[model samples]
Target: DTAVSQTPKYLVTQMGNDKSIKCEQNLGHDTMYWYKQDSKKFLKIMFSYNNKELIINETVPNRFSPKSPDKAHLNLHINSLELGDSAVYFCASSHLQTQSPSSNYGYTFGSGTRLTVV
Candidate 1:
């Protein structure tokens, strides 16, 4: 079973349209994050949720919004999507416990949703 999964693996839409990407994690993690990877493969953190509380919201455009109904789900909604918004959106989850050599501090990432705005 996939620890993290995202729906609509590929999305294609027009420039003025709106779109959403759904994500879910079954790892029972306390924190989730949304990251955008541009054409150059630079990953940027867009938003982060810790136990349903908003934290680490980056300087993304206001057109992008993240909603989390619970600790296991985090959805990204974009309004008036633009060509620049085309990228791979990734959903990741991790436990926020104290760091230790045996502890899993790395994030569990989804396959990624590739959005294309034409």
Candidate 2:
């Protein structure tokens, strides 16, 4: 089973349009995050939810909102989308962090949703 999944793998819309993307995870993790990958492939965290509470990234515009109905699900809504909003969005899940030289900083990420604003 996929640890994390996101819908509408590809999206193309005109500027000023509104759209939404949905995400879910079955890993039973309490923490989930949204990341945006710009054209240059710079990844930045947009939002995070821990046990259904929102932790917004202050740098993110108010046009973007994240909602978590429960620990296993998180969804994003964007309003007044701009041309600069074109990018790939990814959803990821992680639980406990164990620091060991051999242990991978554990995280499972979903296939990204590519959004293009024209």
Alpha-carbon local distance difference test for all models: 0.91, 0.90
Taking all chains together, each candidate's TM-score versus the true structure is 0.91, 0.90
What local lDDT score does residue 76 receive in model 1, on the 0 to 100 scale?
Answer: 94
Model 1 over residues 1-118: C-alpha lDDT tens digits? Answer: 9999998899999999989999999999988899999999999999888873676555788899888988899999999999999999999999974557577688999999999999
Candidate 1 structure lDDT: 0.91
Clashing pairs in 2: none
Supply the TM-score for candidate 1: 0.91
Off by over 4 Å in 2: 96-105
lDDT string for model 2 (64-83, tens) is 99888888998999999999
Measured over all alpha carbons after superposition, the RMSD of each candidate to the real structure, in angstroms, is 1.9, 2.4
Best candidate per lDDT, number? Answer: 1
How much lDDT does candidate 2 score?
A: 0.90
**Quick one: best TM-score, which candidate?**
1
